[model samples]
Target: MAMLNKGDTAALVCCSNGLRPSEKQRIDTLADILGDMGIRTAVSAVMYAASTHYAGTGKKRAEAFMELYCRKDVRAVFDVSGGDLANEVLPHLDYGIFIREPKPVFGYSDLTVLLNAVNASAGMETYLYQIRNLTGACGDRQREEFYRTAMGGSACLYDFEFKFLRGSGMEGIMAGGNIRCLLKLAGTPWWPDFAGKLLFLESRSGDAAKMATYLCQLEQTGALDKVNGILLGTFTQMEEEGCRPRIEELVLNITEKRGVPVAATPQIGHGSDSRCLILGRNYCLNLQGKTL
Candidate 1:
């Protein structure tokens, strides 16, 4: 993949959810921020197009994506926000176009479905980051990390301490996104193939019990059996009493028994200091060394 150089254009696409009246301000704000970084921004028509809770109809959203992908000026694509409807646009996307013209696509949360799908179907690399907060006044770190990752510069260092739960040294292609969103692809062709892969799981919201149930579902479906290791990202709003324990116990039960390396950090999901993770890339997760 080529680096996004000065004056390069990035497309701001809204796939899952429509922008609210207040969020329209973010479009201009993000553009200014990108401009300051020597990058230009182009807002997708679907950002303003609405059909109930979705940014637009599936076909409309897919068209917006295709337009950006096919544009000679556009070097990258960023989802404006994540919501429950991203999967609707999946079947409408032309993966063949991406195969011929691959570029970085960025988002997290509900956009996980698209992130993993694009990589699996089109063989393009996707990034996991929160796009909406990248330009805020207090987001300097995130802004810098995004610049570095998107521009193909140095790797974004994860600063949080990761508790090594099992195994030793491990290396595999980094995979996974929002856990709940990933589950949506279970029986579909879009479901990620985790064989010999480092699986990273994160969530924006959910109780421990609910998370345990989701993990159980993954275990039952044999999704947990094929991965080389597991990296747990920040689980926001899931720290209620007994919730963290159940979630940890479930992961430990599955990974530890299998001798799969496992670790956790509160810096990769919905948190303010979330780091950028490049999906479909090879990375080494060292449990004893506490690095990735």
Candidate 2:
């Protein structure tokens, strides 16, 4: 897939939350933003279809996604927003469709389930980034990285500063997403296989103790043991005085014993300047060399 250029059409999909009357206006602005980047946008028919907090019923949301995937003109798909119910639509999705005709799919947060599932089950690479609440250049770097990675460019080309906590260096396919969302898929068929993968974990509004518990779940499930390395992204709201241990300490304690290469950076999470990461693609992380 070449980099999305002028006239390329990207489908705007709302899989989790429904758009309210006030938020609907932002669609036009989002279109203008994509247009400035030389891309055309098409809103999913069910983007605003409401069904008890979700944009639509599970089947309806699945249908919306399939419609975009099968479109001859659509080059990519972008979720309009993230919410708590994307996993509900997972069972209804046709994973075979993604395998047969894959396109770049962009989203994060609640969409983590879909991103990792499609890659693990359907064998298609997906992206992690935001489409909603994009202000003037707030997410431009992320958008550019998405374009580059989706176009088959190496993720290592982008400059990023990382703090190495353990190990020398490692390389593997990138996997994992929003820590909380990922934990939700534990017993499901969509659960990602983290073995021999570079697991990137990020989250918002979680404290050190809560984060440790989440990490413990992974540890007990044998997921952490199989991963070759761990990249901890921004743990927002974790710096409050009351938060226990701090994120760095928690991560080191959890991963150090495993001897997996561990690194942390605030450049790839819910932060204002998060960059796009290509899930299910191979990446080289050199802690000593200060590269990814």
The numbered model that scores best in lDDT is 1
For model 2, the run of ten residues with the poorest summed lDDT = 150-159
Among residues 3 or more apart in sequence or in different chains, the pairs in candidate 2 whose N, CA or C atoms overlap within 3 Å are none
In the range 1-292, model 2's lDDT, one tens digit per residue, is 4657678888999877777656677788888877877788888888764445766687898898888878888998988767788888898888998988888898888888889889989889898877653543565655555456544455632345787778778788889989989888898888888889999998877777788899899898889899888988887778545577977788788777677888887778876577777898887878455433
Task: Evaluate residue 197 in candidate 2 and report its C-alpha lDDT on the 0 to 100 scale.
Answer: 92
At residue 51, give the lDDT of candidate 1: 38
What is the total number of backbone clashes in candidate 2? 0
**lDDT score of model 1?**
0.80
lDDT by candidate, in order shown? 0.80, 0.79
What's each prediction's clash count?
0, 0
Which regions of candidate 2 fall more than 4 Å away from where they truly are?
49-52, 136-159, 240-242, 288-292
